[model samples]
Target chain A: MGLIDNINKLFDHRIRLGIMSILMVNDDVDFNRLKELLDVTDGNLASHTKTLENAEYIKVEKAFIGKKPNTKYFITPLGKQAFKKHIDALEDLIRNPK
Target chain B: MGLIDNINKLFDHRIRLGIMSILMVNDDVDFNRLKELLDVTDGNLASHTKTLENAEYIKVEKAFIGKKPNTKYFITPLGKQAFKKHIDALEDLIRNPK
Candidate 1:
């Protein structure tokens, strides 16, 4: 496939891209932290996270920290593989441009 | 601005991204060639190229070669600088992840 074909559309959005980029290196990230990191509103973060979760790119776990709700997200194995492919395609486009 | 903020929304589309990538390397490219390179339909290519042109990221020159009308695209200085900044932000996001 061409480099353009390999560039995943899901990661095209800045919010989604930011979410995956954060998840790629970190073990797991919580809701509030992701919001703060991406500098996005709660609703914006929630919606994008839901899309990633639906794609199975990221998995969410809900827990309680002293009775307070905490939602944490982790990148799945598939997510990591797919994101790596996308980044590789971008790098290839920059280096080769064909 | 944050890395996410630095990522240009105009380049979020694969077609537009492809167009800029090609223009960044080539001195100039014609309409049909861009269509072939991007593997997009004429309308698709036209629309994306128009978007770039509207942004002043690219300029369209009209002329005739042997009575055949030709439209060529060249990246503007502003476009080059903006694209470079966007790429740099992506690289920073990959390297620093913050």
Candidate 2:
């Protein structure tokens, strides 16, 4: 639902983009799981996830897997396209560096 | 000197990474020009530039072009490599997005 903005810079911010890129590769990553992998704080993870959710780059689902609650995340189609455009832009940059 | 990091999301920040990528292709760019092109504020651009400068991803030179002062920015060798790695990471993301 969004056009390809120069997402290199938009999604290139380490934390936010990391969340999206990882989610794209993994079917579903839980909050604590990503937090451990990225070594980011809980608040940091939550805030970045909120921003991605607002941008519709990812979808978040909350459920229970036994007694404990679980949160799962997935990259959206729009996000995949955006990531593709960003990669294309990067490739262009690599081939045309001054 | 630095190794390739997962830059897919690192340089993707619109302001910071745009600054680097534009500088790469254009040789150098002025602060005001970038501010106008990116439609960012003075403070926002300044802060973001500081972050890049701190990361050693760019070099800023302050000089005078007549009576007024001018600031010029260029991507360093380290910065260029970092940008390359980031692009590579983005490409990886694009090729294998889930």
Candidate 3:
């Protein structure tokens, strides 16, 4: 009940939801790969990533790829828990609508 | 590829996604009941319902329940098709991350 409200607010945006969904299944997602998969602009992906990162739902890893820097993202334990909860809330809403 | 992008844009909002999910399983849902289930305000639900209605994903039915007006929603055939496609697209994004 209350959990559903939280779930709705947290995953209200599609880009954010997509980011979580991608990070949930993959071991670690690269910045470029997310942009490609989500097909969002660089600015769009960066802003959304920042939101998730600020929430501590994801941790960013940076490395040097030759001369260029590569960024990768990994879901934290907390992120996994929250994302799972959100999914479960959605399922509950679908299965048992009051 | 392109499909994922379209899917992202279409189901980007949680409320819209929620509406589709609820209607998917139930034959018809009342407006007030939806407000109760989603735990959203009247204005909030109305705006979201308008969006989904504009998308033609759900059809609205109006009837009088004892002198009171009752508005119920049912997913149209097209709506069902789109919802299924959107889900398949999400599954594709999750299962085969390419």
What TM-score, over all chains together, does every model reach? Answer: 0.95, 0.67, 0.84
Pairs with backbone N, CA or C atoms under 3 Å apart (clashes), candidate 3 = A14-B12
Taken over the whole model, the C-alpha lDDT of each candidate is: 0.90, 0.72, 0.79
Candidate 2 Cα outliers beyond 4 Å, as residue runs: A1-5, A8-12, A77-98, B1-5, B8-12, B66-68, B93-98
Ten-residue region with minimum lDDT total, candidate 3 chain A: A1-10
Indicate the TM-score of model 3.
Answer: 0.84
lDDT of 3 by residue, B12-95 (tens): 677777778889988999998888877788898889888888888898999999999999999989888998787776666545
Candidate topping lDDT: 1
Q: Considering only chain B, what TM-score does candidate 1 achieve? A: 0.95
Per residue, candidate 1 scores C-alpha lDDT tens digits across B8-93 of 89988888988999999999999988888778889989999999999999999999999999999999999999999989988888
What DockQ was computed for model 1? 0.61
Per residue, candidate 3 scores C-alpha lDDT tens digits across A32-63 of 99898778889988998998998999999999
CA lDDT of B15 in candidate 3?
74
- How big is the positional error of residue B11 in model 2, measured in Å on the Cα after superposition? 3.8
Clashing pairs in 2: A8-B12, A9-B12, A9-B13, A9-B14, A10-B12, A10-B14, A12-B9, A12-B10, A12-B12, A13-B13
Looking at candidate 1, what is the lDDT of residue A12?
A: 88
Deviating ranges (above 4 Å) for candidate 1:
none
Interface RMSD (one decimal) of model 1 = 1.8
Over the stretch B32-59, how does candidate 2's per-residue lDDT look in tens digits?
A: 8878766788998899899899888898
